[model samples]
Structures are given as C-alpha cells and as structure tokens.
Target: GGEGGPNAGGERERRRGGRKDESDWWTRFQNDFPWDEKTTRNVVIGFAGMASAFLYFYFRETGKEVSWKDFVNNYLARGLVDRLEVVNKQYVRVIPVHGSYLWFNIGSVETFERNLELAQQEMGLDSTHRVPVIYGSKSDGTFLMSILPTLLLVGSLLFTMRQGPMAGGRGGGRGNPFSMGESKAKIMKDNIDVRFKDVAGCEEAKLEILEFVNFLKNPRQYQDLGAKIPKGAVLSGPPGTGKTLLAKATAGEANVPFITVNGSEFQEMFVGVGPARVRDMFAMARKNAPCILFIDEIDAVGRKRGRGNFGGQSEQENTLNQLLVEMDGFNTSTNVVVLAGTNRPDILDPALMRPGRFDRQIYIGPPDIKGRASIFKVHLRPLKLDSSIDSEALARKLAALTPGFTGADIANVCNEAALIAARYLNESIIVKHFEQAIERVIGGLEKKTQVLQAVEKTTVAYHEAGHAVVGWYLEHADPLLKVSIIPRGKGLGYAQYLPKEQHLFTREQLFDRMCMMLGGRVAEQVFFGKITTGAQDDLRKVTQSAYAQVVQFGMSEVVGQVSFELPRQGEMVMEKPYSEPTAQLIDQEVRSLIDAAFQRTHQLITEKRDVVEKVGRRLLEKEVLDKADILELLGPRPYEEKSTYEEFVEGTGAMEEDTSFPEGLRNWNKDQGMEESPQEQQRKQCLNTVSHA
Candidate 1:
C-alpha cells in the first residue's frame, strides 16, 4: 500500500510527520516561554530569590529556646503573648507583642493545644484575648543547607586543581602545585627611578651597560651596520660596589621594559621547577620584546658544574644549563639584553661566562678618591647640612676618609650623618656629625655603656696607645688617625688609621704593617709582664698577612718569587696544590715572617715605651684622642706621609657665595617618608666588622 500511488505516498508522508520525534523538555520550554526582556528579567529574579532563600535558611537564627513553664509565665500570664507557631510539630514557638520571640519542645499538636486551652481558661482569658496559633513545616531547603558546605568544598577543590600548576598553561606539570614554575621576575614598564646620573662611582660599568640600552633603543641601527648585539653582560665585584645600580641605570635610561629576577628564584623544592621557570622567564622576556632581563647574585645557580655538586644538588646545574641555552638562543632582533650580577663570579660556570653566552664581563671594583668624591656629592644633596659646609670640599674630605669605600659606603656615610644629627636634636647635620658617622661606619657603634675594671681599662688604653706609637714612627706604616679606649662593637678599644690609597706594596711596607698589627701584644708583654688575649684579633690579622705575603704575594725569600694561588676563605677545596714538603716550607715561611715582625714590633715598643705610657695615661684621662693630641704627646710622625685633606682643599681658589646645597631631585620623593634607596639600605645592611686586612 505505501509503495502504490499518490494516496499511499501522501498517507506515508502524513504518518512520518505524525511520528516525527518531539523536542526535549528544555527545548520545548525555551520555545514556549516568552523571550522578551521582562520574561528574562523574571527568570533571573526567580533564581536570585531562590539563592537568597537558601542562604537565609542556612544562616538565620530562629527564636531562642525556653522551658514551657518560663514561656507561660513570661508571656502568656503577662498578657504579652502575640502568637504561637508549631514548627514541624516538634517544637512550639512563642511570639511576644513587644519583645523577642521564644520556642520550646512540645509533645504533640493535640497535647499542646489541650494544654494551651487549659492554661488560658485557668488564667480566665476570654476567647478574643487568647493567643493565636499557627502551623507550618520547616523549609525543605534545610536539607540542602546541611550539604551546602560539602558542595562548596568540592567545587573549590575542582577550581583550584583547574588553576594549579598541574593544570595551568605552558609550564604545567601533572604532580605540581599552583604556579610553581611561574616566573617570579619583577617587570617594570620603563618606570625605574635610577639613571646614569644617579649612579656616580661605577662610571666604567655604567658606560658599558649603556651600550645595551643603545642597542635596545636603536636595534636597527646596530643591525644595519652588520653588528651583533651582545647576548648578556655579567657585572662582577665585591658586595655593595654598585653592580645592581649599574643594571638599574641601564634599565632606567632605556625606554624598553625591564625585568629582574634573583637567581635563587629559579630553584625550587621540586626537581624540574628550576628549568621550567627558566623557560618561562625567557618566554616572558621574548613576549615583551626589546626588554632587559637582570638576574642578581647569579652565582647561586651558576656555580662551576663539576666541583660543588655535593649532596646531589644537581638542580642548580640544570637551572644553569637552561639559563645558558636561553641566553645563547636569543635572536639578535629580539632586542632582549640579559644582565647578571654576582660577587663570586670566579665560581660561575665557564660556559656561562663564555663570549657567546654572557658576551661581556664588567668588573666594578671599589671607587678611588675621585670616584668616591663624586659618589659623596650624589648622596649629600638630600641631607640638611650646615651653612658653612662646602659640598665640594666635603666630598673630597669624605673620599679621603673612606679610602676603599664603594658608592654604597658613601651613601651610608651621608645617611648615618643625618641620623646622628637627628639623635642629637640638631636642626642640621654638621661636619662633626659626619666625622662621627665615619667612625661609626668604620669602627662599629661605640658602646659607652660597657664598663671596664680599672685594670682592664688600663690594659685597653696601653694596647691602643701601642698601636698608635708603632704606626706613628714606622716609615712604611699608614698614618694614625684616632685611638680610643671606649669599648666599641666586640672590642675593648679601637684604633683607626688613615690607610693610604695605594695599589702596590713593597716588602718593607707589608713588613711594617705586620709590625704595627703586632704592636698591641708586644706592648702588653713588655708593660704587664704577661701577654693577654687583648691582641687575639691583631694576631689573626697578622697571621693572615704573613701567609698572604709568603704564599699569595710571593714576598718570602725562601718561597721564591712565584705566587701560588692558595685556597681562599669560603672555598670548599680540601686539597692543597703543593706537596706536603712544600706546604711545610710555606708554613715555615709564614712563621718566620710573623716572628720577625713580632721582634721588630717588640723592639719598637721598648724604644717608645715612654711614648706608649704617655699616650695611655692621656687616653685614660680623655677616653679619646685625635692626631693633634697624639702630636702634642709625642713630638711628630717621624715618617713622611701625604696629608689626606690636601687634595680636597687645593686648586679650588674661593668658596661660592651660595651657602645652601640645592634640593636633590623631584623624583626622589620625600613625601612618602623614604630617606634612602633600596641600594643604600642594602649597603647599610652589608656593613660588617672592620677588617684590618
């Protein structure tokens, strides 16, 4: 029949149409419901109200519980009852006319009604005066409320897993937690406050780093000339020598993005996290093309591969490997310049220091007198100073005072000067405040609260006086600056010398320094007839100097002229290069040199015994003495030494009429209560006990 004719075909079509599958409930509902704004608004409102109701039921507190007897006495007998409600027939709630509501346990609806009616009748209440009763079941949402916390907890767990490092983008790993491999580099959009002018001491380093900025700002110019941009630069120096400052200045002078990360950030408790982070960091730098990436203290991860892998810490090696690959892989056109800073550059991997990787190595040593003078000028602009203070002369004098000071040290000096002035309630910092600050920075904080016995005080005085006498008379010794018996830092006495700014030292010079270092012990032995532990530090310094002269400096005649690179402090080398016999020879040389210096020192102390006694008595009377006081006691320094203040005062003819130093800079904000930069703070923190060596 279906295959026959037009009627059959039509019937088949009609049957198929009638038997066609209907839409699902949701589709039909959507099709049937009104699609206007009002309907949409009503649906949203419905959902919101449902959610609100659920929350209200979950958190709202019901009426306070009360005993049936109390409820009747408080409300029903007082004629204060408003209404009664029975919830799920398990409890009865009492509502008052002018106070809070109360609820109580009930036996049953029938029993409660009978008891209520009896109570009302016994109280002689009329029908109109009886409290009304209402009945209702508790909201079903209570069951959902009970399970809501569990549902929320499950949802949050799912969300966290979805967002954790295990599920995150790019660097995600299956067993990792949230963002363990995320780049911790700080990114700045050319918002740095440090500039080339802000840095004064590292002129060479700054000039070299500025080349990177030029390459970043004008990449095409370098490329068109067939020049390849440097892949990276390493700024190596002692602590607080402006390695970080030079990097900052490079970033500040450039218009490109600056990204900085500590080398330690690459390391993680997880094995592969360091390499993963290195990958992510490079990815970030590439994403923000024409950017500079700086890693400070890179030696933390860049140590030489084979030597210091003790305890199976191969993570640092893996990180360093990734760093090398990324640094070498940067495209010349990427305009991404990499910079690293480390005080222990000698310990870094040879591959990391290769030309194709780091490309350049800039060593920034401590500033000399001229460089220190400029650094002082930069730090001095912010301090409130006295009217008679000449900025130029002050810079020169401070430079001479701090012979080996880095830029960081000078900043510390200016800051300390201001603090000292404020401590004394002075309106402005004066020259004396600056002098005291220098002493504090060099000799450590003075501890006047430390009281010494009469014998100990006398010992300290003679000990300091012995140092002064030896240094004053020795032709090769540094000029004596000040000697004080007041306890300071961990020492019972302090003596400061104006160490001359010189690079090379002859044998006589080193021998004289050793003698000077041994002067205190010699003086103690001669006068007290017994050696005390007062010269323990001096002995250590003298011993170190003796070894350095013999082994490192090739100053020992027996050890010959060949300087051996001995193991330095903090190095983990357990084996010496030379044989045991050679080691014995080195030890003998060191002992012979020290004994000679000790004998020389003893002879000087005996010859100047009167001078030492005179100085010690004076020190006990005053507790402090300057060069002038020493000169008054002992005739004069027999040796010819250059004056520290001469260069600062010469060739400057006349003083400027302007008495005040100009305000430093608008960008150096004083409103937020910042007195110094982070570099200065870091330098201040790096200050340690003064090392005589």
Candidate 2:
C-alpha cells in the first residue's frame, strides 16, 4: 500500500511537469508576434485618424430629418423655428428652437422659400421677431473641398520633383538634368587578374611600359637616383592592336585602381559641362592615388584646337584646356599615371604630346610572325582541341598565314574556329576548322546562294588565277595561299596570300605589291578585251599604294626625296598646301607609278598566258585551289623549301636569315647615299622617312 501511494504521487508530479511545459510554449507563441516601437506608433496614428473621421461622420449622420407634418405642427405651431440655411442650392439645413440642426431635403430653393414665407405669414410672425428666419445659405464646406484638389496637385508636383533628376543615386549623368557635370569614369579597384603574361604581342610596347610599372612598384629605387617617374604614356596604334588591353595589364601588374573613361564621355549638350567632367575625373583619380587613368579614344577630345569655328568648338576647347591643366597641375606628387590610347596620334593636340604630359609615346603595330604565334597560343588555351592536333605547329601555321592581323583579330579567329567546329558537330576543334576561320575572318562569310552565270564564272576564275600566278612569280611579292572563284563577301572572287612578316619595305618590295594588285585588271583586259566594275576595289588599292609611295614615301625620283604630304588635321577639308603646278606634278607622279606597275603586270601575264589558262580552267572546275593544288598545277615555286616540316622540326633544315635591321637609321642611310651634319641629318631622316607596316 505504501509503494502504491508513492507511485500515485509521482504520477501527479509528472502531470504537473507536462502542464508547465505546455504553458511555457503558449507564452512563447504569444511573444513571437513582433511589435516594435516604430510599427506600434504607425499603427496607433493610423487608428486614431480613422477613428476621428468615423466619429465626426457618425455624429453628422445622426441628424435625421423630422416628418414635414411634424415640423409644421409641432415646431411651427409652437413658434419654435429659429432659422434655415441652404447648401449649394441642393439641400437645406433646418434649425429648430432647441436641439441639433436637422437636414431638410427640398426640391428647389424657390419652392422652399415660398413654403417658408407662407408658413411665416400664416402664423402671423414678423420678419424681425417671428423666429428670425434668416435667408443666409449654408455652404457645406464646398470652397474648402474645391481648394483641396489644388493642394493635392501641388503636393504631387513636390513629390515628383523629389523623385526626379534632383534625386542623386547612380545613373545621374549627362542625361540627368541635375547632374550634367558628373564624371562617367568607372572605377575598378579589385578582381582584375589580367597580367602581362595574358596579353600577347606588342613586345616592344610591353618592355617600354614595364619600366613604368617598376616605377610604381619600387619608386624609392628610382627616387634615390634622382629620376622622376614619367607623368604619362600615350599608346598610339591602329584600332584592335591591343592598346587598351596593355593598359589593363599594366594596372593589374601594378595592383592599383584602374579608372577608365571614354573621351566622348566628357562631351555634353550644355557648355562648361565637359570641362567640369574633366575636373571631376582628375579629382577622382587624385582621391585614389597611385592609380592609372586610362582614356580610350583620347583623340575624340584631344583634336587640334583652333582649326575652325564650329558649333561644338567652345565646349570641346574648354574640355581640352581642363585636360591639359590636370595633366601637369600642382598636384604632381600624387603618383598617378595617365594612359591615353588613340589610333590618330597625328590629329592630337601638340600640347597633349609634349613632355611632362604624355611623356612617352609607345607605338603598338600589327604583330610579326613570332608575336602572332605567341598570341595564338594565349587564345588557344581554353578551346577544346582534338588529341591529334599539334598546338605549337598549328599556332605557327596560323601565325604564318595571317599577316597584318591584330590581337583582337586573332582572338576573333579563335572564337570563330570553335563555333565552326561546334556547328559541324565535331567533338573538338580541328585544323580544318582553323583554316575555315582564317578565310572567314580575312575574306568574309561565303555567300553560297550568290549564284553566277557560266560566263561570269569563267571570267572570275581567270581573274583569281591572274593574281595567283603574278604573285607567285614575283620574287618580292607575297606568296599565294589559295585562289577561289566562288562568291565571298561583296566580291565575285578572291586570292588569299601569305605576306612576309617584314616591317621595313624597300621600293622594290612596294613595286612588286603594286604589280600583283594590278594582275586581275590586266587579266580581264586580255581575256574579255574590256574591264568591268570588278576591278573597282583593285584600282582603288593600286592608286592609293602608288600615291603613298610617291607623295608620302619619297620613292619618286621627281619628288627628290622630299615628302610633300601635309600633317593630318581633324577631317578632310578644302585645303591644298601646294600650288596648282605642284598639284599637277603630284598627280603626274602618281599616274607614272601606276602606269609602270601596270606595264610590268601586263608583261608578266602575257608571258605566262598558257599557265594562266591552265590555272583558270582548274579553278573553274574545283571552285577553289589551295597552295598544294596550285603548286602541283604550276610546278614548285623557285623559293620552295628543300626540307619538309618534319625536317625543319628535327633541326636539319636550312637556317633562317635575320631580316630585321638592328642598326635602323644607319643601315637605311647606307642604302641611300646621303651625308650631312648631325643636326641636318636628323631632320632629313625625320622628313624623308615614314612609318610603314
């Protein structure tokens, strides 16, 4: 019995513990509903306003109207009527001798007035003492209601203004009326992994910029030696030559903030806005010290000033002035390096190119064969190549094939190759894919549906065959790669060639290029006895090349080693630096150069007439002929390699010659017989020579 009693007590205690747990949970659940002070205040304010409105409306609605008979008998008979008021001529407010005002629904003001007067007269009440029935009307707050709408409109206007251009938070630039002067430069401070190793080609440019990076990284080393860091560098090159990429790589290498802005970003519709933006950009660069400020297409804002009075001159001039001031301002100790890129260095303002501004002008031209190979290797790293492919050999082959190709063009070729492989459902990119990509990039997409007639096909075949044969036979001409008659791009035919990877060209080399360019026109004249519009582009190229050689290169004997070409201005305006007689001589020289090249082409094609016909026939049948097919049809070229690719790879082939002139001006001076004092010699070299790619 005692044990059972203990067990019953323990059971009761267990039930109490369960109940306590359940109560704790209930309390926590009730506390979980959040009610912060801010939320509570807002809720209370909302409820208070709603209640005030509700009570006011409820009290007004309680003023119910009495019956008309009751009003006349009880109120009028007892002389208890006090006054009456009208609201908007719609409803009447009736006032009794006692209690609150009651609403009297009436038909019209005239009827109500008539009824009131009759009742007053019947009751024998005077106008002054008989309840004093006032003729005043009740407005029912209509004026206040009318004014409420205007107040709402004003409030809306204020709200829209607050949320409009005056509101500053991102996207407040030229288009924003309130922030027209804000700088559009984008800041990149981190996550930039592009280093010098990733950027290919421009070896000379890379070496030139490496010192700047060292100056930034180890400034004390140079400062101790009393050498001031260069203020800026101007990257001048053709478009797509990797000028902008080199700047990015420099920033990455220096591990500093990169502030980039386009030159056109400074221009605005409003005056002084461009100058303001320039100031703001520099201020931002100053804030982030030891950073690189890269201005892409700087020529857009840095054009030669005072050329002419125009619409945008005032604003652009102010912008250029601000840029000049910022480049060499009093804040020179900030360690900020400015990098500007443009393809038209000739058109830039002279002040912008002077020392202490853009102190270094690095030229990044098209890559040579070895540089192109390195570029190919860099771009080919991520592509899924086939197992059998020799990447190094393929890179060399592509480099050899694509001359005058910039870094951007090579990257595009690599992407195009991958897309072609995917379209053909290949597992990996193959050599054929790369070959097709090169053709596509150089010539353009093949217009397969552009059908030609039999006569047109034969004419096109003969045209391409002429180019191939002429270029193959000429010693200094580019080697023929392939010839095609199938329509591609805007042309009816094309002949691809492998140009030598040479920077400096002699007069003989330029003449050979001109002769090869004229071959197609000569062929058309011989076969059809007339030339068509097909030679329009060919004629344009030959004409430009001949004029460059004469007017720019000083290759013409009549020019006497004097270059009469004027410096490039902003645009081609109506201006001639020379007299009418000199213009005639210039035209005559251009004509003579073209005539000589045409005669040479005619002679070459006339001698090889049978070979042209044979090559043309084969081109018409196959629609395309690669190097191997051309070699088989016309026999091997005079400069054919005695060893194969395997032999060369095995190091048993003939040694390659060094074509570069390391001695530069000295070698060129020796070739051309001229001697003068040092001062005059430098001027002559600068005057006669021009940069050619």
Candidate 3:
C-alpha cells in the first residue's frame, strides 16, 4: 500500500503542474516568506525599493552620459585604493583630512588622473565610460546632529552650581553654613552685671563666695599659707534665698570667665549624650582657665544615685560621673572653679559632698530682722517712695508680717507695693501701700465687697475687738497694731499685733499669748451669752500656742523643763518626734493650759466689763483701729508703771494709819470683843453650831 501511495502522489503532482494557474509562483513565494517572519526581510525590501527608484531615475535621464570610471573613482575607489596601496607596500597607509572634511573630487584634471589611476589599479577597470560622480559639498545644516553631548554638558553645569554653595569650597574658607548645627559651649568673658552689692540679705553666703573669688584671683597667696583652695562650693538654701545671685556675683567680682548652665540641660533621652555634653563643657572651661562654671539646681543630676526606682539609672548619672572626674582630676593651679546651687542639699549624693568635691557648703537662710531691713533698703532704691516712709519702720512691720520670707520675698513685696501705688494713681508708694502689699503677699488678694449681713458684721467686729482688748491687758502679749472688721482675704475680720523682735520667749510670755488668743471666745461667751463658730481660728491658734508652750517650750508645770520638739529638717513632712503616750500627755497638758488661759481671760474681761464694751463698740463703728486708738482706750501698759509698793503704801495713807494705832489696841480689842466684827462672829457661831451637831 505504501509503494502505490508514492506513485499516486507523483501522478497527482504531474496533473496539478500541467493545470498550473498564473498566481502559483507568487503564492509559493509568499508561502516561503510569511508575514510573521518579515523582520530581516523588511530591511531587504527597503533596500530593493531604493535601488528601484535609482534605476528608474537613471533610465528617465537617457540623454545624460554616464561615466562608470568617474563614479567608481569618486566614491568606491577613494576608500578601496588607499587600502590596496597599503597592502602592496606591506604597510597600512593613513589618510589626513583638512579641517573637518575630506575632499574627494576637486573638478580638475590632476584630481581626475589621480583618481583614474587609483581606480584602474584597485578595481582592475579599463578607461571605459564610467558612472559620473555626483559630488556635493558637505551641507552646513542649521540643526544639531546629536543632542546628547549638549544635554550632558547642561546637566553637569547644574550639578556643579548646586554643589558649589553646599560644599563651601567656592568662596574662600567660608565654611558650610549648615555646620553651625553643632552647638558649642559659650564662655562669657564679660557682661556679668550682677555684683555682690546688688544681692541683699545673703551676707554670710556672700562672704563665703568672696573667699572663693579671692582664692581664684590670688591662689598663690593661699598656697603660700599652706591652704588648698576648695575644688568647688555648693550654695544650699531655701528657694528664693539668693543662691543664684551669689554665684553670679562671685563670677563678676572675680573677673573670670563664667559658664552658666542648668543641671537639667545635661540630661537627655539619648543615653550617652549627657556625658558627652558634660565632657565638652568641662573641656571648654579648662581652655578658659581662671573660670567659674555655675550649675543651677544641681540636684536635678546630683540626686542620691541608688534611690532611683527604675531598674536602670538615668543618663544623669553618667553626666554626674563626668562632672566628678573633671572637677577632681583637674590641677588646682588651673584655677577653674565649679559653683553649684541647690535648694535640696539633703538629696545630693554623699560623694559630691566629700572633701575634694564641693568642699564648702554655704547655707543661705531666710533673712533676719536686720537682714530684712538691709534687703528692703536695696529693693526700695528704685521705687518712688514717699518722703515720710521710714524704711526702718517699714522693715520692722514687714519682718513681723513675714515670718519665713527670704530676700527675694522682700523684693517681691516692694515691687507689689510700687504696682499697687501705680494702680491707685499715687505719685509715690506709701506706708499704706506697703502694708496692703504685705497682706496681699501673705493672704493673697483681698476680696473686696464681700457683703455680709448686719448680724454677721456685728459678730465679726466683737470677735476681733475681744482679741485686741485681751491682748492690750496682757503684759506678755504682742502689742495690738490694728483691728479690722473689713473683710480681707478669707477672713471677715482680723486683728494684727506689733510683733516684737524677740527670738526667745519666756513661760510668762507664752501664757499671756495663749490668754490673748482665747480672749475672742471669752468675749463671745460674756457678751452674747453664747459661743459661735467664729472663734474657730482663735481656738485653733490658742490650742497650738498652748501645745507649743507645754510640749515644745516645756512651760507647763506637769511637763516641766522637758521639751519634746525636734530640730527642723527642711520642708519634708514626717512623724512627730515624741512617742504616742508622750503625745497623749502633751495633748492633755495643752488642753489644761488652754482651759486655764480661757478661764483667766474670762475673769479678766468680766472684771473690765466697761472697758471691753467700750472697745467693742468703737471697733464696730470704725471697722478698723490703729495703735493710737488702742492705747487711748486701754490706758498705759502695765510695764510703764514707775511707782514701787512702798511709794504706793505711803501715798495711800496706810503708813499713817498704822503709826497712829494705840499701844494697848491688841489687849483692849480682845476684852471688848472688838477684834471680830458682827459678820465674823456669825460665821464663828455657824461653825460652832455645825460642829456641836
């Protein structure tokens, strides 16, 4: 079957070829070169189309003579002959072009001969009619041939311009402006305006700082005396006590470079940044020797290291370590001093308080009376005060009003007084303004026009008047300064006392003070016939005074000469020093003492009923009183008495009566039963009757 199939296919092919159509060759050609396989075929097709156009043009120009020799000589022979000549000479020949182009045909006989000979030898062509060369000069086109080179040049120029300013290499040694981001420690050589004289009420601290300043200025003098200058001084004190001021004053007076930084600034979230900054700061300070580096509020970084509750310590520990090493490692001859200030000295690390580091701790405490006066004088210099305003008297009043106020507090008071005077349109700050300022500072701004009912006003007036009258009668009590029913701050009324400058108080003084405090309640019971809650403050004050006298001052008879008070340790709150049972006894003693004082006040007021009523009535009418009004109403104080007991007896006719008595007076009186009056005889008879029964 397979052998028959080949003969059958041959017979079919012969029959189909015998009956072939006119499109058979075209169809066979298209089958060989299909549309999908035309990528290489397209290039051949394009070249064929160009050749066809050229042939058609050549055929159309039939009258024109064609020179094949010229064509070959001008175009093909120019490249081929140069290569053949090199081959013949056994060396490659190099051709040079004038300017930017080569000249192939110059339209001259010599050029034709040279080209003709070259083409004859290279192409083996006789001098037959050759294709004529159609030579054209190189066209100078108006458009660019390639744009990549220009674009590259422009891009490079832009990059250079952008980098020039940033790299800082274009304009001399003016470095990159962005380099300033790295901050540096600034050591101030001048412009320290604060001096020791400007600081007030810190004489002891100032003296301590002055010694350090002197050491810095003349370290040789101290060295000659075998004294080592302190490595550092820590200014410890309550807030607003001029610690910072003293540090600045030392820097200014010593004429040294000063670097001021807060303790908190050395701490940061980044772990090692703090220590890095600490090293940088000290390095700068050392460069500027004879300098003072002041760290304000050092406790921010100097807290006792182990107390931190977090599992890991703060970065401030690293900073503190750096500070310690820098301070102790530096040579003493370098004259670089570290001054630190902290209100909380107790929480500082023990190592910081050692002999070589912070060797001296100067305490700046609250100002005393004299210090307050000096502080007032310094602050009052700028204020426009009235001529009649005596600073000493004002200072006395201020010292009494402010128990724990510091120098800064006094300055604040003076500023507030000036502001008050300005608010009232007064030309100068007066004593009244100063007083009001003190009240404002102590109790806060007064709530004016807190209107009360007539009954409440009467009660407040009587309540305050009671305190004043009792205090006036008690010799050991503070002298009454003023009593006011005008509502100020939280109180509806208040009574002020001219506090003495005494630092210590006697037992009698404490007793009199307690009685004076109880006077308000006593007056309420005596006049109103009932007590009111208006005596809440008075009772509290009396109770506290009595307890202080009995337990703290050891003034009570039951707890004689046994004080239970402990020394103050700053502002921290803690348990009482005394035991529970001792506290109970103290409480009982305090209550008994206060009760006795109240009884005494009640008796005294009852004895002077007329005087109490008079004072109360005047206070209610005026709503305020000065010391003059109190003195005029209560008469002179008991201490003002100059007369002795003998003088009193002689002046009262007692001595004359005694001298004139009869010699037999005693015998005669016994015989006539004259010794006993009728009242005495009745008392005797009653006693005898009771005894007989």
* Winning model by TM-score: 1
Tally clashing residue pairs in candidate 1.
0
lDDT of 2 by residue, 244-285 (tens): 999888777666788999999988776666777787788888
- lDDT of candidate 1 at residue 379, scale 0 to 100: 94
Q: Residue 145 in model 2: shift from native, Å?
A: 17
* lDDT of each residue in 337-367, candidate 3, tens digit only: 8889999998899998898989888898887
lDDT for each residue of candidate 1 in 584-655, tens digit (9 for 90 to 100): 999998888888888988988999899899999999999999989988999877777766656443454532
Q: Is candidate 1 or candidate 2 better by TM-score?
A: 1
| Best model per lDDT | 1
The models' CA-based lDDT, in order, is: 0.81, 0.78, 0.68
What residue pairs are clashing in model 1?
A: none
Model 3 per-residue lDDT at 576: 80
- Model 1 lDDT, residue 32, Cα: 89
Q: What RMSD, rounded to one decimal, does every model reach?
A: 13.8, 16.8, 34.8
Candidate 3 global TM-score: 0.60
Clashes of each: 0, 0, 6
